[model samples]
Target: MSHAHDLVPFFEFHLYGKEQIPDLSNLPEPRLFSTHFLFHSLPDSIAKSKCKIIYICRNPFDSCVSVVFHQCNCTIIITQIILEEALERYSEGINEFGPFWTNILGYWRESIETPNKVLFLKYGDLTGDVTFYLKRVAEFLNCPFNSEEEGNGVIENIIELCSFKKMKELDVNKTGKMVGKYENKVFFRKGVAGDWVNHFNPWMVEKLSSVIEERWVWSIFLISLSNTYISIMA
Candidate 1:
């Protein structure tokens, strides 16, 4: 299970929405579901229930650029030109759905508070140290990798299977229609991190950070909020 956008990257993986997931009320215990819904957006049952959320995040600049590239190549779904027009709009904080800062803060705050329920992952770290993070994720998922039997090759296998080049070449990813919308864009497109450096100028970076710090005060407040809320609500 994974995000709709994350589908092409993980060939042979199934994708589903939160509401569409099995009831789990009558089911046996362990369950798994990958979702795009943020912390506040999850259902009350799932929020209150015992379930792990692997919150994978990448640098906002890179994420924004990737989203634009992915959207542009796929049926003109998100008709925003990041190079000039969209960049102008982004500077003024005019976007399809508010700013990207808000979206990132939602998960960042969640990871800080509910450390047990949520595990924070950076895309840069995931690519740089795949095995270390994979082990951490496997442990969180309760699917411990047997290092003795597999001799660390198991981790490499998983990562290789999900690699950008490999996934892009697979029939399931390259040919199959994903989520009935996205096309021409494969799941894996230049999976390298820190690519934002090539695109964003120093001024742009500082300006974006300032905007984030100003626009997402709610997230900051939430993180420093009373323990009463955490005890009562969470």
Candidate 2:
């Protein structure tokens, strides 16, 4: 499921302020859910439970670009603004589920403090070394592949099935509608890192870099990652 709302209807209801909380007693254990909600805003049950969270954060530049295209394709009333305006709003943390730094840092700190509960993954790192990270994820979920499974090419098959190209070609993804409105294909854009350079000019780069430098200074790891992205894409 793409979101928690698919299985737990009340998550959507709660998000929009509907009072009804659906009974989840019928759902089986080990239920997987995904959300864009901030760390602090998550339900108390989740905070207190022994559930694991895997947060995959993309470089802000690419994230902003992707959000722009996604909103424009999925929403009506033309939420798509010019890149310049989008960059301004993004830098100011005005977009959906933003301010980006706050959202990232909240999870970043939590992952540090409670490593077993939160596994923080960087999108760039995952794409760069899928095998290593995929194994990491499997291990994190307590289902690491045995040597027999590895020899049988299970990992390779899983990677190929989940690859962006393969997923984009799937009939369900190509023609499906999500949330009864969004075309599932909208989520399958370029699916590559560093595509932000095509959309960002020199000024935009400087502006976003300044924002990251200022806001992310507290986290050396994030700042280093941001700097590496800037350098590679420069």
Candidate 3:
């Protein structure tokens, strides 16, 4: 499944305080799951296991805008806040699963320390060249496509299947609620990088940029990383 909430009851409880957790032991091996939990918070078993972990970090400016839309759209979560208020919260690292740099840096450090066990990907780089990154993911998972598969357009087919436009149009995604009250459609916005530009004013840009700069001042790697991602979109 794409997300832990899609299968595991433990994750559902952890994320939304739901009491009913289903039995997942019967599921087959090589099961893939995704989560937003920080590295420090993940189960001990996951850390000890040989399973590969891929962490995708996004540009903070676009992340903030997307999160605000998610929170505001899900009325059951909290009272909807305006864009200005959301920007302020994001500047302070106050959103859900936030302290944003901490989350990114945690996995980043792990990826460096144990390169085989963890893969760090930037959302901008993935968007900029999806086929390259998709192959990277396949290789990382030990399932690299052969020349014949590539020649047969298997890679292209997978990309088309998972494209935001295609997935958003699926009946399963377009209909029904998830995690109790969240409409499935809320998860599918524009799905494009750099959308923050449309919502952010000069002041918003300055504020977030200053925060990112301050947060990454000591880490030359992060500064370079952020610059590379931003430049890709530019």
Candidate 4:
């Protein structure tokens, strides 16, 4: 998902969504772009550039649920796709623009290897403390909040603007269209971090947990995220 994507002021495109030619690369200093491409598949120019990348990873449970909801709604006609099928595809990394593990772990690994260049944030942590992370984001992008900006409540204003309650109610989001397949309104589903709990049955939950263990257990990706202070504090 592109659920909270609207808050990012200037992403050229959601690379995971449609295969449109992105007009992003080589724009200037501090251009923002979003992508689901694995580290191996990322365009050579971007990987080699001095650009900073902010990649957010949601736990597989929630990511899978969100993608399922998104797929069900984006269809033109009613389809009875089941949770089991979605979970199976997700675990196998067979979903669109996936293997989900590859997309996630590739960034996770890069963020570990090049912490300064890739600021990896967890979706749960970000929504939990937008103020702190927003400040971190600004600082990472080299436009940190100064004393003057702090006094002006710039951080608070930015927090309120991107808050779920505020963003979901905006008229532009209520009506705007993107990439033709996704209606903007559909993107604003319940943004709670562990929303997967409400939808996943016991078997589905077990399968994802197993997949997570098998795929990430030995990987330094999530484990090493602590080095950059982007992962949650103990």
True-vs-predicted CA distance for residue 126, candidate 4, Å: 0.7
lDDT of 1 by residue, 1-234 (tens): 333344323211242333364444553456445655556766777777778877788876787667666756644544323544555566565655455665567777777778787788888888888778988988887788885736947777888877777766765556545556566344557878887677776767786677667766755776667555768897
For 1-234, candidate 4 gives per-residue lDDT tens digits of: 344554353233554345666554535644555666677877677887788988888988999878887887755432335777878888998965768777787887788689888888999999888888999989888889999999999899988877888888877777756655567877787888998887887888888889888887755555665555754453
Given candidate 3, what's the lDDT at residue 103? 87
Residue range 1-234, candidate 2, lDDT tens digits: 343234443344333344665555656877666677789988879876788889999999999898888877745442324788888999999966769998998898778768888999999999999999999999988889999999999999999978988877767676656667667788787899999988888999999999999888856677568768988999
In angstroms, give how far residue 223 of model 3 lies from its true place.
Answer: 13
Best by lDDT: 2
* 180-225 per-residue lDDT for model 3 (tens digits): 6667788887888988888888888998899888876656576568
Clashing pairs in 3: none
TM-scores of all candidate predictions against the true structure: 0.73, 0.83, 0.83, 0.80
How does candidate 1 fare on TM-score?
0.73
